[model samples]
Target chain A: MSEARLNTPISPFPSREQKQEERAARRAAVLRAAVRMFNARGFHATSLEDVATSLGISKPTIYHYLGNKDQVLLECVTIGLQQLLEAGAAARAGPGTGADRLQSFLRRYAEINMDDFGRCVIRTGEEALTPESVRRFRDLKREIDTAMRELIEEGVADGSIAPVDPRLLAFALAGALNWPARWHDPAGPQSPGELADLLVATLATGFLPR
Target chain B: MSEARLNTPISPFPSREQKQEERAARRAAVLRAAVRMFNARGFHATSLEDVATSLGISKPTIYHYLGNKDQVLLECVTIGLQQLLEAGAAARAGPGTGADRLQSFLRRYAEINMDDFGRCVIRTGEEALTPESVRRFRDLKREIDTAMRELIEEGVADGSIAPVDPRLLAFALAGALNWPARWHDPAGPQSPGELADLLVATLATGFLPR
Candidate 1:
């Protein structure tokens, strides 16, 4: 929740120094390929060989960097969640009425087009992981959910948001944020920002709010 | 959406007598196994052999009954969707107003706690289907969406619901309906009818339309 802690580095923040940047890019490329195949074909359906082939890299390199296929997946999901949480935390920390903070955070998330819509490892799907891995992802997921819920509750208390069940509101907001992975098209009529705005307005203003 | 049209046997629904009833039971058993597997392990992660093994049948028997893996999946999804749509339709036919119909339909879906929790094939990790499968599913998907949206639109027009973009309302209603797949638990605090009522009330009342 603290500003400095919120912006703290997530696995070194995918560097900008040339050598490090190239390495980060390759790592990202691997993660990207993994997500496409994992999401489209499924994580179990995909193999280390498949990921290596897609990346034009040796399978050994992947093992060296991320340990195994599961680790690679965990990293990808964690990275994505960390990004959202960071944005959400920063937004909440901003100087504004609760609505402004909530909107600011959600808009950034909405702009995340559907192409990268991997299921968050912290959500229930992490049951796909090994027992040890499950503990970690579950902890992270609950933390994120709790933090996000607190932010919304704050907005409600400040009178920016109308009275709504915080829990249901969480689900609704999470549902909208999570839906893009299921339906977003890069070539679609509305851009991510436009879609996010529409969602924000709809949730904030009840369709038939008295 | 004619009753006769839906009643037409689609392979699994072979006969009208006890023979057909037997077939339907067999089909439901197979679908139950498939759902359990798909939920525990994702679709691409699951193998036909695994499902066959779970059913205590040989691979050949599964193939004989359902043709191939894709067809089995198609049937499983069809079964789940048909059950959901039929429940919605029945509510529509028995309701007081369009809003009432929508609320009843929503409540019916909330019955995830009764026993059908996470059994809805349309929600949760469905992206891995082959393109051909996606097409067939989309057709059915469209009909359900249109039917639900029409109900919402009617509610708005009748002053029973607030006037909002029917399209967005459709999406939000969808978000609400599909949410149970993620969180509903029969062993949890809420009953199926209670959860459904809460959801319908939340959605119907808007922020405060109640």
Candidate 2:
């Protein structure tokens, strides 16, 4: 190589930060591809080979990035659950009445369920996971459930929400929100935000007129 | 043979009705066993052999009664859908305000989801069934949706229910009720009937105070 070429700021090889960013971007791409296929075809029906094929990469590359299929699934659901946990924490920490915070959290919760990773969380059954993974999945899910119940309890305590069984109410709300993952068509006219708002409105006001 | 035996009115062979009844009973037993196993282990993880073993019958016996695994799942979901349809019909035909009838159907809808056949319907995904069976399953589910929508429409027209999108409301109500199939414990202290009532009440009143 010429001295002038060597002295130039631009290098043929990627810097360490560039390499790390590229790796993170590639990992996210694989996860996105895997999660979408899993949601569309189901975990049992989808093969890692197909996910790799969709990404124009080799199966070994997927393994290098995300481990095995089970691990890919765990990662997807973990990301989704973490989003929910963060939403709950944000809502709790934000200003307004208890009901206001809960409503904000529920909207985000519904919207997340309609997204790629969150849809995977709702669509995946425990039977799809290895025993160890299933335990971890359940624990993460239980934390979200606890977070929801606490929101309900806070709302009830403040008298902003109706007096109801927090557990039952949480289940009802979660089920209503989780269902969009099953039935929502991304190609449909209604956007996830609109659908989430409508669902939350129905839950807040109920079937009965005020 | 004794002359008294020849003269007896009773025959050694079963009557045709007796044979029919026995066959029906056996088929029901097989279905019951299969649905329970499917709900517990999930449709993909469960096998006909395991179901047969649980009932002390052979796999062929299961096939003889319910065709194949996909067919068995189809039959199970069909039964559950039929129950929901019947509930809708009965509720519609009964004398009361539309809200009253809707609430009645909702309770039955929730209770049925906690039962064996209904739980199977909720747990068994479309991917688990054959393409043909998936079509049929979806058609039956659509019928139930139609029934629910009509009930809601009637309630809205009669001013018994708040003015809302019947389709969205049905989805919300069905989702809330459908979820118990995933989380409900038959062995738990709360009965299906009680849980159903609680869920229906939650949906009816919603989270906001009355």
Candidate 3:
């Protein structure tokens, strides 16, 4: 066989699954850059060109992978919410107690908010999205809120957490977790894990002396 | 003297101080409406025309009173921060321990986030602002953050609050307090004051059983 033909068989031409994996990885890279830019600059001020430029990818390549700015934002939020939902499920399924589960979930929640994808979820406003996108985003957000409230309720029922209004308590905790996305700097003195651990500890056990 | 001349002395065509008060009140009214709309529809989607229409005033009137859209947003944030600063000062000077002072300040902070001016401050991103305006806003926000940390430090020193990292604690508390601005609805089931009180209580005392 010719040298080129021999090399083709040697590389095996990358199976379809491998090709798909490569495509997914590229898409993920684009998303990471988009989220970082959107977090630094407001969604309204950021453009697809800026995201593409940051990644050294062409605008068409971005469109080919991410669709558009709105789509990119939607994907970012979707990924973040999915991660949160998964963490919630894990915490619920595997835990020492209700309070333990809630704290574990909350630590993950706070840590996520400090990441690029999580920050994008918090930073993207509904106004920037289409009505349908907004509705979907709201639904996902509601799911997360519900999961949090359910954890608190479980804790309360188990006598591990106080009988506080679950809805309000969830909002308070969620706010605290989400707020870091707006201000957390990766280059800051404290790492995301340290901040998350401190915050979760404060909530799980009151900051006031026992 | 004629009847008109005698009545003129009674009315006095409005004193300069009265006129000034009226102008100030009108300007405030314009700001109130603008902030509400900005908070509801976002600063970018909202137009002076929309605000003017909502307030039954002309666009030029909004311009005459509040300058451009950026100016209106800046003023809203400025007013909100000033109110917060004033509350911090009061809490610091008021009687009780550091915990009490911090709670008092946090209550006001949460309440402020629920109001139009306060919501505007939280909702407005600095990406839409000029460099000078962003600088001013950051300075003001930094002042508020410093005040919160100071209050927390005082509480720790006085043995009112637990020995925790004041910076992290402040971030956690501030995040919870500021979260209301993003979710609290005026027409919602609970009043802003009630919600603020409940949230502040949760953070101050925490939700775990004593």
Which candidate's TM-score is highest? 2
Instruction: Name the lDDT of candidate 3.
Output: 0.88
By TM-score, rank the candidates, best first: 2, 3, 1
Tens digits of per-residue lDDT for model 3 on B1-210? 898887665575788999999999999998988888888788889999999998888999988988998898899899999999999999999999999899899999999999888888888888878788999999999999999999999999999999998988898998998889999989999999899999988887676777
Q: Estimate, for each residue in A1-210, the C-alpha lDDT of model 3 and write its tens digit.
A: 898887664566788889999999999999989888888888988999989888888999999998988898899889998998888888889757788889989999999999888888887777778888999999989988998999999989999898899999999999999999988889999899998998888876666777
Q: Tens digits of per-residue lDDT for model 2 on A66-152?
A: 899999999999999999999989999988888999999999999999999999999888999999999999998998999889988
Give the Å shift of residue A12 in candidate 2: 1.8
Question: Would you list the rank order by DockQ, best first?
Answer: 2, 3, 1
Tell me the deviation in Å of residue A163 in model 3: 1.7
lDDT of each: 0.68, 0.92, 0.88
- Residue range with the least summed lDDT across 10 consecutive positions in model 1 chain A: A115-124
Order of quality (lDDT):
2, 3, 1
Better of 2 and 3 by TM-score: 2
Single out the weakest 10-residue window by summed lDDT for candidate 2 chain B: B90-99
- For residue B18, model 2's alpha carbon misses the true position, in angstroms, by 1.5
- Fnat values, one per model, are 0.21, 0.73, 0.72
